[model samples]
Target: MSFTLHKKEKLKSKKLIEQLFAEGKSVSNYPVKLIYLKTVHDDGSKIKTGVTASKRNFKSAVNRNRIKRLMRECYRLNKPLIFNNIVGDYAFMFLYLGKDMPTYEHLEATFKLLFKKLIIKENHEKLN
Candidate 1:
């Protein structure tokens, strides 16, 4: 894979988010929630993603923004692993669930674990 930002896709639209939340499966191990669904877009190579930090967890915009930044950075760095497993165009949302932000190491390790689990979960779901 190129691992270029040019191939990075954006997941927009309220309906898509809601559908992913309602119908897709979530993998959570504290501090992070991965919600994903295989979406049929015209372009199968696109992998659209969205990041969110709940306002309920952190009222301050700075805190929320910080968490989002961390999530995006981790995703940008580690997305190749995810891209490899995706069968087609997909939409994903990463939500921060921790009360306080963790260190980069903590986030990176946890994010890696989460993605690994997600790949397993996706395979399990596909068989059913």
Candidate 2:
């Protein structure tokens, strides 16, 4: 799979976003938390993802935007972990949960751990 995160791969539906928070399960590694929901999409994409940084924590649009950019970049690079390992289409939201600014290295490491945890959790669920 390509390493680019295409427009269709972005999660933009208001209804879907609401439902995701309502029914989605989450995996977290410190400053990063991934919330995911299994669902079909009309676009036939394997996954649709969104990233956010809390305004309360960030306090500035620039900081929040920077955090969000780093989150998306990390997800874009590491998404194959989910696409190759998981079997179904999913909607995902990555939330920044820390009170301080984050470095790219920190986010990348957290993302890898978070995705691994998600994979393990999904595999365990399937086995049950």
Candidate 3:
């Protein structure tokens, strides 16, 4: 599968977003927190994702945009790692939580770790 994230895979449901924050399970790795919920779809395909930079942490819009860009890039590159471990549909929101700006290298490494954690997380959820 291609590493490109399509428009269809971008999470944009306001209702789902609210539900996500209310009912999702979260796992964090320092500068990033991933909150995800398994969603049922007729096709049982596709993982929709969103990214956010808290206004509380990054006051400037530029800073927030930059952090979101980095988050998306890292997520796009490593998503295949997650796709291998997941089945059906899931909606994910990646929240940036760092006090200061983080480098692309640091974000990339952390994203990799997050992917691994997500796989383990899903496996555990399946067992419970």
Candidate 4:
């Protein structure tokens, strides 16, 4: 498992992200909320993900963009754990719920923790 950051792993479509938000089940664990839906594709070889920071919290576009960029970077670095652990494909939307912007260390730790929780959820489901 080479943790290569690839273009296909990025979730870029607004419509798809919104659809996932509308149809997906969410899990919240303070400061971060995850909205995920199982997706089917003939080429189900990779996972795609998106991140958002609420305007209601940061009113400034600069702040929101900065938060989103940080979240993406954190996810990019941490997501290979999920890719290696899960057996199948999934589409994930992560929303930042904190009132203040987090430092890189905080974001990275939270991202890894969330991914680990997700892997545990996936494993638990498989055992059922």
Candidate 5:
């Protein structure tokens, strides 16, 4: 798969987002949390992902947007971890859980760790 995150790969449907929150499971690595659900999409994409920064933590929209941008970039770079190993389509929401602003390096590390944990969790679930 390509490193680029195309428009179709983005999680945009309001209905899907609600269902994800209601039925999804989560894997968290410190300031980053991945909320995911196994579901098929009509678009045929293997993963549909979204990133969010809490407004309660970051009051300014600028800071929130910056954090989200960093999260998206980190996920875009590290997403192959999920795509290559997982067998089915899933929806993911990456949530920023810390109160402080994070640097790219920190977020990147967190993203890698979080995805690794997610893979392990998924595999373990499959075995049961």
Candidate 6:
């Protein structure tokens, strides 16, 4: 599969987003919190992702956009870690919870760890 973050891979349904935040399981590793739900889509992708940078922390749109830019790029580059390991569909929201902007290296490392946790999480779910 190509390593491109395609438009179809984005989570855009308001209802699905609401359900995700309301009932999805969440895992955090400092500065980042990953909320995910086991969900299927008509599209053939294994993962659908959404990203956020809270307005409460960074009041300006530019700052929020920049943080989102960094996070999306980090996720785009590293998402296959989870995609290659999972068996079913999943919707993920990667929330930035840090007080300050993080370097790409920090975010990338956290993302790798996060995907590993998600793999373990999915495995446990399958067994249960």
The TM-scores of all predictions, comma-separated, are 0.89, 0.98, 0.94, 0.86, 0.98, 0.94
lDDT per model, in order?
A: 0.83, 0.93, 0.90, 0.81, 0.94, 0.88
Q: Model 2, 11-121: lDDT tens per residue?
A: 999999999999999998998888999999999888999999998887899999999999999998988888899998999999999999999999999999998999999
Error of 1 at 58 (Å): 0.8
lDDT of 1 by residue, 4-121 (tens): 5444376776898899999987888688988888887654546788899989889999989888888888888888888888566788899888998778878888889999998898
What ordering of candidates by lDDT runs from best to worst?
Answer: 5, 2, 3, 6, 1, 4
Model 3 spans with C-alpha error above 4 angstroms: 42-45
Q: What clash pairs does model 3 have?
A: none
1-128 per-residue lDDT for model 4 (tens digits): 65555677777768778779789877666688888878864454467877889999999999999988888888877777887788766788889999998888888888888888888887887899
Q: Write the per-residue lDDT of candidate 6 for residues 59-98, one digit (tens) a residue.
A: 9999889888888998898877877888888899999999
Which of candidates 3 and 5 is the stronger one according to TM-score? Answer: 5
Candidate 2 has which clashing residue pairs, if any? Answer: none
Candidate 3 lDDT over residue span 39-116, tens digit each? 964444578899999999889999999999999999998898988878778999999999999999999999999888
lDDT of 4: 0.81
Mark the 10 consecutive residues where model 6 has the least summed lDDT.
79-88
**Model 4 regions lying over 4 Å from their true place:** 1-5, 42-45
Backbone Cα, N, C clashes tallied per candidate: 0, 0, 0, 0, 0, 0
